[model samples]
Target chain A: MGAEHTHGLHLPGQSTVHRLPAHLKIVSTLAFVLLVVATPREATWPYAVHLAALMLVARTARVPAAYLATRLVVEVPFVVFAVVLPFVATGPRISVLGLSVSEPGLVAAWALLAKGTLGVLAALLLAATTEPRDLLTGLTRLRLPRQLVEIMGFMVRYVEVVTGDLRRMSIALASRGFDARSPRQWPVLATCLGALFVRSYERGERVHLAMLSRGYAGSLPVLDAAPLRVGDLVVAAALPTMAAVGMGAAVLTR
Target chain B: MHVPDGFLDLPTSLATAAVAASAVALSLRGARRELDDRAAPLAGLVATFVFAAQMINFPVAAGTSGHLIGGALAAVLVGPWTATLCLTVVLLVQGLLFADGGLSALGTNITLMGVVGVWTGYAVFRLALAVLPRRIGSVPLAAGIGGFASVPMAALTFAGLFMVGGTAPLDAGSLVAAMASVHTLIGVGEGVLTALVVGSVVAVRPDLVHGARRIRAASIQAAAPAPSSGHRA
Candidate 1:
């Protein structure tokens, strides 16, 4: 919605968390999420520790609690979906707030809620601290396929251009006194997207021709060859390393 | 739906990551055949276009609106392989940048939306096109059918995957019913929109549509043999 702000989730900051290289952050976050998923969902303490670590990172990055909370709203839909488990799941019944819910489903729901929260927050922290371009660079450094990386590069580069076009077209649709508020208006809305698609496709063809003229020989030049420093790796490894410790404890304690 | 982490167990997530990686790799090679040298820029733009297309919010109820999941539309416009690649990038970016889908769940998302969604939609589209007629005008309707079916198919597959690796113990019948039924309704809106959109583009440039390109070629071939008739136009 914020066309002016290209990378919507990223909040600009100068903290040490933001200073970490994106590739390192990407690996660390992935490791954290894997750890979160692999954790014993029944272990209550690990979930709490995971949240604390996430909050600590948010603090270190200087991202506002209010901002992170607002962004965390994306997980609300998953919460809604998980609530149905209690009603549908087959298990011993229990009463909560005068409502009968399955006992096993209740535990499962709690696990889902906890794990989903930690996982989402961990991801949000990375995105909030890193820019989109840096994320791609991180992918490249991690040795994702060259063509895929370049495709992603073009995607990152032209997202604004395409989105700007969409914004303008949306305005044009609004200028005509049309509000897409019901299923009946679907054709009109889709027609707008269709026109957008045609224009974008033509533009793509033109772009290809332009690139061919400019000596783009089916490959983009690779950059970001700087070696990963040991200190930076240690810094990036800190959060995930702590989570790994907590995970080991949780497994051992159980 | 972009399944966030914790919905599926680690084994499931890891398995899906493997599945997603293989599908993306296969699609990358197939797209090279479909696009050749023009693959990089065009597919990238198509990815952005799909990203933009997904921004369309269709009103489902009085207050609720749903976003368009664009496997069929993208496949019909671009080819299926490119659509797969494009959707994968859209998903990867969404995961990395927006935190829209989960980081660990990236493989799951790509598998569902990119592989299941695109291929199911495409298979149905090609089938619909074959069954209905062999003309350009049939492309939109076929695409609509594909779009309509893709959602529920994905939802059904999600139910299956969830059953296999769900962290919770939910009844299979209820799970499938819930996922499939809701997505079936969502599919109606998607189907209509996809049809209208494809119809719009097909009207302007049938040759531009990957689905309709064969019809263009057929029409050209039909005209090619008649030398006298070729002189008239």
Candidate 2:
């Protein structure tokens, strides 16, 4: 599970998008998503424009189109749900391939699907570019409370260890002739989970004790400096500006 | 449970963010007290474990798959304060680094799955524990009920948000019913996993389980030989 983080998903490129400040990008991501949400279902062209703009941004950012497609597939559930809306939606019926589907419903479904996919893609692009450590720094700089950030740092560091613990427990259970396929083995699995919790608890206690011994007050020391430069501001401004314009136009039209 | 962006309307998303940020703030204050030197790394481990466990999706219906929310499990194992912080980290990393959740919808996701799910599940678990037999084994029952209940609650929250910003043709009543129905089955998987995890922990390091700590201690006290006449029983 930990190894999944190092997969081929993140391709290093010296692109401008990859160099932007995480905090600004995060703000932009929010604004962009709001713009997508604000776009009316009736105005198909606005959404199309939004999609085209996103593609252009991705292209400029040097995000591989193939990667975007792969990522979009993960939103398939929402897509399926959107597809069903046309049939179930209460509106005037229209014939398509010898079946009746509501015109408004079809339009609504298309909007939902398109908006959801675009939002997901924008988020994916952000994640693809930013490193987790730097993102934490940016959050702390943005006045996200120090304590929360510290806890997040620990979680990022220890998530792998916990996963390893689970994997080992499962393997040990398997070795003991406990097959999870049958109902009878469920008790064993339950027992294993309980054991895992206890281990994690003990680990927490030990960690706490160690921290106490080291003169740890409530807050942790900030790991690195986060200097929000002029460049960061400029890069960050671009996305939000686009989002504000797009969303504002959509709202005005509606 | 990992809601991507654009699922909810702006107002709902913003409101949820405010609620979630407050919850995170309160939890941070409490968690700071809990996180001595040793617990910091353990917090990380807990988050990672959750991430891994979530990947192992259990089939709800034939084709549909649902994964553990892990909020109740985290809260019961660690204290609710620490559990909330742990979940917040997992969600943040998943959203920011792994692209598992949407960046913009982080607030709503944390509100539903982190704060609401854990507190609701843990509260029910504590109540159930009070009514059930005073035994270490009873933690699983509490966990199962907690897990079962939280999923629908989160789904309902999602439905509420959807109603506010929905672009689709879904009616509130039908959406709620459909969401609750699908998530009810998902809750079965959640219940089984949470119970199993809680039960196993109670077996070995009962002191580690925040929810079961009292029962374990009581059981230990009960097992001890009757105190001398001068000694307190």
Candidate 3:
């Protein structure tokens, strides 16, 4: 969980991209990703266009290119899988640099890398520009289930608290000379997790009691119910619209 | 695990999304019954705890580490219904906030991790509980087995989906074989983590555990007759 907060990826700024409503940003990001997903694997130029658009948004949001590049390590597993595909895939063989690889596998690997990278970039842009709380608020405004939203709000608030608890426990374990580096040490790690869970569950029960005493009902009150503005809608629609046009052209030309 | 977009075709993605939606809807109804006033907050906390737990990577080998998927662990602590919702919440947060998983692949992730992972893990837990000794000690063992089995099951499920609409031309047999083998190793990590967590909770607060409810109920029944007989005598 120490890594969870570190990887939250939000950088504080008041840029116009950051100023946009969370719902608008969410919609725009989803639309952009959908377009990326639907694009044919062979349509390499469309991805280039998508990347350029992402760069423009990133520049507007003042997100560093290096930061975006670093965050992409999350896709390393898929990258590995993509890399291995050409070697293992069964298809017409092609020779590149004296290495014969499956032709279809190469295409698949390219599609995966291109589309996956674009999708991750779009998601990163959204996370970088918007606060987590604001994103939940945006989900709520986007008409996500109230119960789900409430649960998510609680999760966002307490993930760090639990992780803090985990850190202290790890410190305690380390103080006791319990370093879990081997399978033999798994029991100790598990016990720590077990202890952490019990503590969290009890804390949940106590918090519920405290809230109940204060006349808390099933639902928490929503403080902000701001409606989406026309300007926000127009701005949000622009990215999707542009992507759609690109997608349409790509499909028609193909 | 966290499948990126374009791995599966559009039809497969949309289909899995539909399935995930229905599963969540069903879980919502089931969670309503599971989460009473006292339990509602615990459900949220459970999700947060899983979120936190998933962040702590335990070393499985010299170069490999794995974290708790928390499917069986959550289902054992809370009900399976609540566990699914918790996982879904975790996945959503990770996808939206962390950019860890793909937005287009959200449905597929939810289906695999939330639906398949939780249900299969819970099923194995229940099966183990039925066969194992009826002591509180058995809860963790059963959960551990369930947790261990769940990882490979989820991996196989992904392989099945890939067979249907994979964006690549790879042979299905090799994909399944590779996925299952790697995941089996990860499952060992999952099982140990689950057992440790479940055993610890059973030691301290057995009543809070959903999977151990039958054992608690049986214990109460066995204890109830003595007090009532004394009163009658």
Model 3, which residues run further than 4 Å from truth?
A: A1-7, B227-233
Expressed as tens digits, the lDDT of each residue in A92-191 for candidate 1 is: 9999999999988988899888888888788888989998878888898898987888788888888888988888988988998988878888878888
Candidate 2 scores an fnat of 0.54
Predicted complexes: DockQ each: 0.73, 0.50, 0.71
For model 1, state the Cα shift of residue B188 in Å.
1.7
Candidate 2 local lDDT, B1-233, one digit each (tens): 56766666667778888999999889876865665544456676676666666765444444555567898888887778878877888888777666666666789889888898888888888988999998777888998888888888888878887787665566678889999998888777788878877777766666667788788768767777565524433
lDDT (Cα, tens digit) per residue for candidate 3, span A119-205:
999999999999988998899888878888888887787877888888899889899988778678777777787788888888888
What's the TM-score of each model vs. the native? 0.96, 0.88, 0.96
Q: Isolated chain A: TM-score per model?
A: 0.94, 0.84, 0.95
Q: Which tens-of-lDDT digit does each residue in B1-233 have in candidate 3? A: 69997898888998999998899888877998887755457777889889878877787677777788998889888989999999999999889988988998999999999999999999999999999988888999999999998999999999999999898998888889998998998898898789988998888888888999999889777878565554422
Lowest-scoring 10 consecutive residues by lDDT in candidate 2 chain B? B56-65
Candidates sorted by TM-score, best first: 1, 3, 2
List the pairs of residues colliding in candidate 3. none
Give the winner by DockQ: 1 or 3: 1
Which tens-of-lDDT digit does each residue in A27-125 have in candidate 2? 777677877876666666776667776776688788888887876666777777777889987778999999999988888777767777878777778
